[model samples]
Target: MAIHLVGLALLMGVIISIYLPMITQTAKILGSGPMANIPFFAIALVSSIVIAIASGSRTEQFQKVATLPLWLLTAGVMSAGMIIGSSFLIPRIGIGAFFVLLVSGQVLAGMVFGYFGLFGVPASALTVGKVLGALLVIAGVYLVTFK
Candidate 1:
């Protein structure tokens, strides 16, 4: 089960990375301001609505959402920030560098979050391997970032 989940996670990671260039190009076309974020979210909202309707559990999901704290609902804000920031950075840094840096930061932050169990992530003791993996990611970012 764990191996299957890990594979699924890697697959999703690849998908998200592949999406970077698309958004970057859209940023170039739309001009990386409110214009970029607006259409992006509009599409996302529509897609989400379609999925929610198709789920056949829309009422249950809405009930679940209501039970959550207000702070939790602000995840959309974080998603917006990620898209807006990525729109600006991907074109400037180039896709490879932006993705490398993003993955590096995610790994490092994940290490901290996993160790401390922040944001409800299950606690895992930091090990030498985890730190080494993060260092390798940083090194990769450096290689991808510089000429």
Candidate 2:
């Protein structure tokens, strides 16, 4: 299970690396704002539907979605906001700078969320090692984002 999770994480890294460039190009080509979501999400929706059908998962499971807290539903909104913001920023900042800044924010947020166990995250106390690692990452972010 751990091996599969590691593999999945590695795959996600590749996808995110490609995703930044692809979305940046798409935004440049479209010459439109958030409307770029139209084609991107259209493809995503179709791909997701096909995958869902192929996976043989039970559609009935989605019925439980309504039982979840309303705040949980906002995750979709957050995803859209992230994509849109990334599209707008990547071209101006350069992908390397943008990715580092994004990573920096995620690291900080991940630490806080894990520490407090907010939004379903498992509680984990902040340790000196984690703080040092985060500080190193933040310093890296500053170096990459600035001159």
Please give the CA lDDT of all the candidate structures.
0.82, 0.84
How many clashes (backbone atoms < 3 Å, residues ≥3 apart in a chain or on different chains) does model 2 have?
Answer: 0
Point out where model 1 deviates above 4 Å.
1-4
lDDT of 1 by residue, 1-147 (tens): 699999999999898887656666787887664467777789988999899889786877877876889899789888877887888887677777887788888889999999999999999998989888888887787778885
* Counted clashes in each candidate structure: 0, 0
lDDT of 2 by residue, 1-147 (tens): 699999999899789889867776787789864777778878988998788778888477557767988888888788777778888998889889988988788899999999999978899999999999999998999888896
Instruction: Supply candidate 1's per-residue lDDT for 102.
Output: 84
Worst 10 residues of 2 by lDDT: 57-66
| TM-score of candidate 1 to 2 decimals | 0.86
